[model samples]
Each structure stands twice: as structure tokens, then as C-alpha cells.
Target: MDIKLWQAIIYIVLALIIGAAAGFFIARAWFKNYLKKNPPVNERMIREMMRQMGRTPSEKQVRQVMSSMNQVK
Candidate 1:
């Protein structure tokens, strides 16, 4: 390959690597911020939701629901 071609190829590869790394970090940060703003379903929310549905949730049921939700994640 010509010297200039090799240099161009090297620059492109470096840019791709840097872009990929930057994209990964940006996406990771966005996801964390989204989670902080929206949050996830928790045991207290589940219990409240169940209560609103006119069913009293037991401790064991709440724990089971929380475990199931965690497993999906």
C-alpha cells in the first residue's frame, strides 16, 4: 500500500475506535440518567399497586414479586 493510504487507513481505524468508545460511554451515561429519573419497580411500589387493585399483598408475595422483577433484569 502507498504510505498515504496506510496513514489514512490508520486514521480511520483510530477514529472508529474512539467513536465507538465515546458512543459506549455516552449511552451508558444516558441510561444511568434515565434510570435515575424514572427509576424501576420496587417492593413498595408493588405493594401500593396491589393495594390500589383492592388486594392486600403479603410480605412473601411482595418479596416474590421483587425477586421475579430482578430476575428479568
Candidate 2:
């Protein structure tokens, strides 16, 4: 019946959406945990460098330092 077919389609769509959302959340959590385990050393170095530079470090600067640090081997 047409009604049954539509119901099946709706269920499939809902399942796909739920699966995608769950995948995104899992990936985000895993990445956050990985970063916590591997602390950003470059950012720490940059902060020390900034202190030596006698300049007030901003949040943006700290992020930049972390980004650059992530690029290192």
C-alpha cells in the first residue's frame, strides 16, 4: 500500500539523520580526548615567548600558537 511505502521511507530518512548526528558527536568527542592526551607544546612555547616579548597575549594569539604547534611533527 502507498501508506506503508511512505512510512518506510520516513523511517529510513530518520534513521539516516540519527546515524549522521551520532557519528558527528562521536568524532568530536574522540578528537577532544586526543587533543587532551597530546597537549599543545608549541602553544606553551609561544606563550613563554610572548611573555619574553613583554606583550599582553590575547586569546587569538594563543589559538594561533596552538594552530602552529599542531603543524609541528
lDDT (C-alpha, whole model) for all candidates: 0.96, 0.87
For model 2, residues 1-73, the per-residue Cα lDDT tens digits are 9999999999999999999999999999999999999865666677788999998798898998777667785
Model 1, residue 29: C-alpha shift (Å): 0.8
The pairs that clash in candidate 1 are none
Please provide TM-scores, in order, for all candidate models, with all chains considered together: 0.86, 0.56
lDDT of 2: 0.87
> In candidate 1, what are the lDDT values of residues 10-31, reduced to their tens digit?
9999999999999999999999
Best by lDDT: 1
User: Model 1: residues >4 Å from true position, as ranges?
Assistant: none
Angstrom error at residue 12, model 2: 0.6
